[model samples]
Target: MQNDYMIVKEGGHSIALENGVFYNPKMKGLRDISVAFLKAAGAGGTTLLDSTSATGIRGIRYSDSGVAGLTFLDISEKASENTKRNVKRNNLEGISRVFNKSIQEFAHTREKFDIIDLDPFGSPMPYMNDIMKLSKGGTIMMVTATDTAVLCGAHPKACIKSYDSRPLHNELCKEVGIRILMGYAIRIAAKFNFGVDVLMVLSDMHYMRIFYRIRAGAENAVASMKEGGFGTYCNSCGSFGYSKGIAPVFQQACSNCGKRLEAFGPLYLGRLYDKRITGKILENLEDGNARKIIEVINDELDIPFFYNIPKITKLRRVGSASPAGIMSALGNAGHRCSPTQFSHSSIKTAAGIKAVEKALRSAKDFRLRAR
Candidate 1:
């Protein structure tokens, strides 16, 4: 089992697909999950866009799933060409179409899709608005963000810059990372007059994946998101921390022992896993390989509760902004990198979440005092 190849058999058919071209456990598992969801949704005859169509694996997978209108896009000529060949090889010639252009350019104003998927190597932040706009009626958004720093609350400033929310850099707020990521994706949907309801979410190591049911809403969602606060988990020994839901989480020391705790602010504070959806999807995973992986997911879900930590590296930061661009430059550039050095002052508190007005007022006061 080297990185040299993968043999992906098409369903129960005798067809076999092989090459070093596309191979990843997570990608394969997630593709199957999406299929299960669409089947359960009982929604057919819809459009799907694979914005970052790496090797066209996702696009092909979706087509094979029986999703009606599938559009696969890639910035590279070679990549898109490969996608075309794969589609033809799989006999999905008419069902799927591959595009040679950046998703930024291909996601057009005139085009509306039923589902738009963004699985960039890192952050999917910048393209949120575009994804929302392209989704017509009630489009489903499936976002995969592997850059945990912004989601986990590692770089608070960076999180705010990309997601318009803060991360709670702690162990307990595993839900915080997913929520923050969801909140940001929702807000992006909102801007295009798309309201968001998180249909399902699976927050795993190194990445946070979300499936959203998006609709129209401009004012309501934005007003709700402007509120902010710190997300906190125990800094000393990684214990269960709290989300004050009040702005200004870092103004005080740890509640447990007065020790300074690491916190991310106002990251969407809530539960991460959904048992119902996870169960349904797993139930549909009847195939041997898919069932095997689905069992692992089921086990993780069955656990009472677990730690939530952000997984981001220096290199991943750049991936969010431009995944296709980065990949072309370095085919496989990502490797384990050192975690960000945590400082004592980096810990935050929950008050930063309770009231944004108070937090902003404090910021203004700080500016005034400096003057």
Candidate 2:
């Protein structure tokens, strides 16, 4: 309404998306989470770069959240103009700079930002190297990848080509995709002598986003690289496990079902969240959807991956069991368990597949007796 392209309001601000300028309303929840994360991470008085700014919504919201300085970049001249207009509309012009250039061009400058966000249309891989040039010690990088198919095994060749890792195309693929993305980031950052410490991760609809802090040191980079490894999964029995290291000898067959095992990775085998930061994010969050997702992620176990309850039950020919009931069964048996944000029907636990199968059997028995 204001700029002839129709004004839309989100996150307490009005933004107009010019033709050819990308703005997704569905990502508002993710944006809300980003705002909460920035506030929780002490964004006040820090410089932020919206590396792929389109409609300038992200940068505007960040500025409103107390970011001291802001730089918006977009390759499309129209997109750049749109961002500048939005910045002016939001009264952020004084503290904001809009550049009609690609991140690769912007990297030519020696300026480094305290926070950098890369939310491109598809994969962020094409821009990662230049992003590293803009990062320094204690830099917080927020990356979003919508090429879920490539990272989730729908296109194994593409995944291998892009991430240099294999992916699983199963119920666990989403988490695998996140790990693959993280592993790729770790490798790329290490090349520049930067270590990555995952602060938070989310596998939401059609995309996966990661927040990580950069530590500057060759030793830290080496330590971070040690977290990369392969994940071995059994298609026959659905049992999976991972080993820490770039290369570790894995059994050729499923230890439980004796079927040939398939491996995916060179993926990250480290904790996915910083519990302290997650708690702080929860405290600052106000959006209902964002809060709900963050709550599940905050409580999620730091386990490598999760098991889809429905998949396990179907494989075992048992009646479908509720995730809560399964968690209860595992807890009663003295195993730590939690529902995963990755999938509503999945649970993460240190208990082996055999224990989960046992819990499924008990749930089926209980249901029959009740009936």
Candidate 3:
């Protein structure tokens, strides 16, 4: 019966998913992500963890990938039980362990792992420190942030409160949303004394997501957000774009139409991918052991936007055709924004410009309220 859910292979190896289980379509792509990391680690087996093993699929696959051991954990009792069942069925009862416990309880203890994964439902905001607890040197943390729309600078204050960082929206590509989320998550991780390196960044079907391969220690990993700057975006009719390395000027109105422009703050540029790791993973993707999933690895490696830009956290884009217009608008407003991302649904010129003016007024309200 298990075979029905699995694709059995030549050596009697198989891949299967539990029936009536929690499955995000991103789950499949997630599998690809884990495999890529494992291949990059350059070991037969590594001590890998699925911090929130939703269906235990990631943990199970880790064990199957010639990993020496796997620790599958889930707050959900059913998920832990499901992991146990799958491990048993796959004959991984020996090296794979599943636990139903609070991540905080686990974090309070001393346990170091080669990889500590956190794929929580929405934000991993709750578990940043616990993740640090389990990690030592060179620890790779696979983090997934699925609450993309909110984190994509759609709402500056909301994204800030939720992620504890800023978000920069990119309008040129549909992927700007997820990139914004990843950028925010990275900045937050940095504030906690660990540097977040994006191992993989991807977007698909209403979901903007990323897999961060994080390690402890803030130095040598990335440039601190202290020195970083922001990007402003324009939201005008058909001429959407972004500007960088400058302040937003309020007086900057849309050249297309002599109307005021909405200015989102200096959003960060998310650029923390490890170039060596990214390349090494692609180079050593194959051996006699795996021929089945090579295509996925190759496809991911070829993404155009995959680059290692350092020290930036998040970048925001509203919809300006040129970055100058965006920066000009923000600068004129006499409003100071963090280097992190910020965007409101407001636009540039006329109706959109009115929204921008309104946003400035609100920021003032927030500042006054703080006092």
Give me the overall lDDT of model 3.
0.52
TM-score on alpha carbons, each prediction: 0.67, 0.96, 0.62
Each model's lDDT comes to 0.56, 0.90, 0.52
Write the residue-wise lDDT of candidate 2 on 212-290 in tens digits.
9999999999999999999999887789988898668778888888888999999998999998888999887885888
Tell me model 1's lDDT, rounded to 2 decimals: 0.56
The digit string of per-residue lDDT tens for model 3 on 78-126 reads 6677667767767888888888987888887768887777778777667
lDDT, residue 15, candidate 1: 23
| Model 2 lDDT on a 0 to 1 scale | 0.90
- The candidate that wins on TM-score is 2
How many pairs collide in each candidate, listed in order? Answer: 32, 2, 30
Listed per candidate, the RMSD to the true structure in angstroms reads: 14.1, 2.7, 12.1
**Candidate 1 residue spans exceeding 4 A from truth:** 1-7, 10-26, 153-160, 164-174, 219-229, 236-262, 270-276, 287-371
lDDT per residue (tens digit) for residues 185-240 in model 1: 65566556655555676655566788866656665455434433454554543334
